[model samples]
Target: MVKRQAYQPILITDASRSQHDQLRSRQLRYIVMMSIRAACLVVGAILVGVKPPLLWLWLSLCGVGMVLIPWLAVLLANDGPPKEKYRLANRLHRSQRDETPPRSLPAEERPHPVIDAEQ
Candidate 1:
């Protein structure tokens, strides 16, 4: 089984607030669907009885519920700020470093005498 990894922050400068809200809403919808599916399975089991055949079905539903709950907690539960996104972006920036020298300033612009970097 592949172990799940924690989410890393990878902030995209272009991401808009509306996009974030839309993603949050979709996550909430998944949480609701999983909840309803679980309820249906439990009520169905109680109404019809957990026989040998139904036992396997019940177990399967329980397994699905187990998986869904954690995912819902991670994706939909608002955790105040998006720290993960920022960290991820930093990691990406670090991996893309190049050692080229910076472009020289234009000849028309003289260096300001008051600004001393040699200090």
Candidate 2:
């Protein structure tokens, strides 16, 4: 397992520890998936050997998992974590906010005065 720094964003394409960590995480998931697949196969085989006809349907399902798991694992292993996503609020600095228009628009925009003069 790799340690990530406190502040910096991890670039998906960078050849850094962050990318390697992402791959490691994915491999860990694949390991769990494959472990479960193997367990299913073993159990299915055992049941089939004891009484062949009864477990045939289950064994077929296990075979399907055996065939598909490797393909899925390879695809997952190649996948990288998504690039850092910063929202509008997080991206803009307080200084930048000063440049933007105020909450209230110009008086001309509203036909009626927001505050009535008569009290």
What TM-score quantifies how close candidate 2 is to the native fold? 0.51
Q: Could you give me the TM-score of model 1 versus the true structure?
A: 0.35
Off by over 4 Å in 1: 1-13, 19-27, 30-37, 43-57, 60-71, 79-81, 84-119
The TM-scores, one per candidate, come to 0.35, 0.51
Locate the minimum summed-lDDT window of 10 residues in model 1: 110-119
Q: List the residue pairs that clash in candidate 2.
A: none
* Model 1: residue 64 alpha-carbon error in angstroms: 6.6
Whole-model lDDT values for every prediction:
0.55, 0.61
Which digits, one per residue and each the tens of the lDDT, describe model 2 over residues 20-105?
68778998989987887788779877887787664768778888988898788788877764433432233344335445344365
Stretches of candidate 2 exceeding 4 Å from the true structure: 1-17, 82-119
